[model samples]
Target: MLFFLLLTIIICVLVMFYIKWVKVRSYWAERGVPFDPPNPFLGSLTFLMRKNPSLWMRDIYERHRSRYVGVWLFWRPALVVNTPELARNILVRDSGNFRNKFMTASTSDPIGSLNLLLTKDPAWTGIRKRVSLAFTSSKLKSVQAVAAAKSLDLVTRIHEEGVAEISLRTMFSDYTTDVFSAASLELDSNTTLTGEGAVRDITKEIMEFSLPRGLAWCAIFFWPDMAELFRVNFLPKKSTDFLRRILRAKFKAKSVELNKDPKTVLEILMQMMRKSQDQEKAYSEDCIMAQAAALLVGGYETTSSALTYITYLLAHSPRQQEKLYQELLVAEEKHGHHNMEGVIADCQYIDCVIKEALRMFPPMAWLDRVALHDYKVDDSLTIEAGTPVYVNGVGMQVDPEFYPDPYTFDPERFTAESIPYTYMPFGDGPRICIGKRYAMITLKNAIAAIILNFEVLPCPNSPKPAEAEIQKKGLFLMPGEDLKVKFISRK
Candidate 1:
C-alpha cells in the first residue's frame, strides 16, 4: 500500500509540471508576439553562461525585425524593444510607469543594494537628486583639471612602458583609476605611472571575472529572486570592506575641512549628510559608502573599456586615424597641447570618433526596466503588470536600416544628422548615467593626449577591432582578450 501511494504522488507531481510547462511555452504565441522557442529548463536564457548578453540582444533584434520580441527569463515572460519608437515610449515617453529597473542586488548585501544604480523609487529619486549636486558644471570643471594632469601621466606611462608590451585595457584601467581617485576621492594615485596602488588593486579585483563572480552578476541582473535566495553580492565583500575602511578614515579626518568647502564627490556626499536633519533616514553611513562604491565600479570600467575600444579601432583604421590626427593638430594650434578643456570643446572629429566607438562597443549595451502596471505595448499586446523590459540599445545602433555599412568603422556616419531616439550609450530619460559629462571629459583628454603624442598601430597577429572577442563572462561588453597596439612616438 505504501509503495502504490508513493508512485501515485510522483505521477501527480509530473502531471502538474507538464501543465505548467504548456502554459509557459504558449504565452507569447497566444499573444501573437514574435519570439523564438524557449528552452524548457533555462527558458530563453540558454545563452547565459556561453554568450555575451549584448551579442544575444543583437541576435534577437536581427532575428525578429519587429518592434519588439518576446523572451523568457527562466519561465517568466519578458519583452525586448527593438525599434527606436518603442524604445522611446518605454524609456522616455512613458518613463513614469517604468521608473524602477528589473535588475537588483540581494538585500542582504547593503553595499550592493543601496547604490544609485540599483536602488528603486523614492530612494532612487532622493539619492539621484543629492548625487546630481556632486556633478554640476563647476564640479566637472574641477574634475577636468584632474583628468588633464592624468592625461599627461598617461602619456608618460606609455612612453615609459613600451606600447608593444602594454595591454590596452589594463593600462587604461590604471589611468582611469588614478583619474577617478584624484577627482572623486581627492586621493592622489600613481597607478597611471607605476600600475600599483591600494585603489588600483581594488579596481582590479572589481574587474576580475571568475565563474562565481559572473554567475553572481547574472543572477543579480536577470534573476533577482534567485539573487536574493542565493545571497549573491554585486561587489566582492573584500572590495566593499576596503572601501568602507578607507571611506570611514577619510570621513573622520576630513569632516571639518569639508564642512567649509565640499569639493570632491565623497565630500559632496558628506556635506549632504551633515545638512540632513534625519541622518540615518536620508544618508546613512551605509548609503554614503554605497555611492562611493558605485562611483568606483561605474567610473573605472566604462571609461577604461571605452578607451580600449577607441584606441584599438584607431589602430586598425589608419585613414580615420589620420583624419582625427589632422583635426587634433588644428585644435592644438588653436588651444595649445595642455588646454584639454579647449580641445574637448572645439574638436568635432574626436567627438565623432568617440560616438562611433561607443556605437560599436557600448560598455552597458541594454537598458532594463520593469512595468509598474498592466502596460499597453501596442494595440495588439498589453503586457501584464510586472513584466521585465529591455531596450536593445546596441542592437538598434548596429541595425543596417538605421546605420549604413554598420559593420564598418566610419566616424563620418555620425557627422550626418542622426535618427531620433537611436543612440544612447549613456542611456536615456531621468535615470541616465550621472557620470556622463565626467566620462566624456576623461575620454576627450586621454584621447587628445595619446593622439598628440603617439601614432597608434595595430600589433602583429592582433585581431581587428571588429573581430575582437567580447567578454562572455561579464554582463558588460568588455574585451575578452588582452587588446594590444604599438604606439610610435609622433615627435
Candidate 2:
C-alpha cells in the first residue's frame, strides 16, 4: 500500500510539470505570436551572457520589422517592440496601454517595492510631479553653477592627480555625484575636489544592490517568494538606512538655512509637503526621503556613464577633439570665461558629437515596460496581459538603416532635419528621464570644459572600447576594463 501511494505521488508531480511546460509553450503559440524559440528556462536571454542583449534586441527587431516578436524570460512571455512606430505607440503616444515597466521579482521585501521604478501605484505619479519641479529651467540654472564649479574642480584635480592616466568612470562619477548630491540632498560631496572617495563609497553603499539583491531580482521573474526568502533588494538595507539618515540630517540643515534664505529642491519639497493640507496630495517626510533616493539613483550613474563614454570617444578621435577644442576656445574667447550657456547653445558640432556618442553608447542599455492589459501593435500581434516588453534604446540609436555605417562614429546625423523619432538619448515619451535639462547641461559643461583644457589620449596600455567592451553582461553596457586615458593638459 505504501509503495502504491509513492507511485501515485510521482505521477502527480510529473503531470504538474507537464502542465506548466505546456502553458509556457502555448502562451504565444495560441496567439500566433512571431517569436524566437526560447531556451528551456532562460528564454531569449540564454544568449544574453555571450552578446550584448541590446544588440540582440535591436537585431531581432530590425530583422522582424513590422511584426512583434515574442521572446521568453525564463518561461514568461516577453515582447520585443520591433518597429519604431510601434515603439513610439507603446512608449509614448498610447503609453497608458503599457503603463508599467517589465522587470519581475518576488514581492516579499518591503524596501524592494519602495522604488518608483519597481512599484505600481498612483503615488508614483504624485511623486513624479513633485520631483519634476526640481529640474525646471530656472532650477537647472540654479544648479548650473554647482555642476560647472564642480567640473572646474574636476579639471583641476585631473591636472593635479597625475593627469598622466586615470579612469574616466571614476572621475565622471566624482563630478556628477558632487553635482547630484548638492542638488538633490543638499549635501556637498568633499570628493569633488580632493577625490576623498567617502561620499561615493556611501552612495555606493546605498545603491549597490548587492549579490543578495541581484539574486533577488533574478528570482523575481521566476518567483517572488524566492525574493522574500533571499531578502534580495536592489538597494541595500543599510544603504537605504544610511541615505535616510543623511537626507534627514541634510534636510534639517537645509530647513534651517531656508528659514534665512533662498529656495532649493529640498526646500521646495519641504515647503510643499508642509503647506499642503490635502491628504491625497500629501506625502510624509519618509516618502519625500524615498523620492530623493530615487532621484539620486536615476540621476547619478546615467550622467556619469554619459560623461565617461564621451571621454572614451574623444580620446579615440583626436581630430574631433581638436575641432571641439577650437570651438570651446572660440566660445570662451567671446564669452570671456568657460561659458556653459554660450558654448552649449552655439556649439552645434559639439552637440552632434555628444549625440553621436550617446548613439554609440546609451547610458541605459534598454528601456523596459509591461503591458497593463492585452494589446496588439497590429492585427498580427496580441500580447497577453502582464507580458514584458523591452525597448532596445541604444541598439535602435545605432541601427544602420536609421544611421548608415553605424559602426563608424559621425556627429553630423544630428545636424538639421532627420527622421523625427530617431534620437532618444533621454528616451521618448511621458516617462522620459526627469533631469533631461540638467543631464544635457551637465554633460555639455563637463565635456566642453575638459576639451577646452585637456587632451585625452589613448594610453599605452589602454584598450580600444569596441575591442574591450564591458563584458556587456550587466544591466548597463559598462566598460570591461577601466577606461584609462592619458590627459595631456592643454597650454
* Cα lDDT, all candidates: 0.89, 0.70
| lDDT digits (tens) for residues 1-491 of candidate 2 | 99999999999999998899888877777877777777776767675546655567667867666346777777777776655777788888878876666654335444445555555656567667766777777777768877778878888888888666788877787788888777655676767776554347656664353455445545653344456666566566666677677766765665433243334667766755554434564666555655666677767787888788888888888888888888888878888775677766777778888888888877664777878888876877667787777776665677777888876667767786545456676777777777788888788888888888888898886666556675344455556567888888877
**Where in model 2 is the C-alpha error above 4 Å?**
47-52, 62-66, 104-112, 206-210, 219-231, 256-262, 272-281
Best by lDDT: 1
Candidate 2 pairs with clashing backbones: 105-220, 106-224, 470-479, 470-480
State, as a TM-score between 0 and 1, how close model 2 is to the true structure: 0.90
What are the per-model numbers of colliding residue pairs? 0, 4
What lDDT would candidate 2 get against the real structure?
0.70
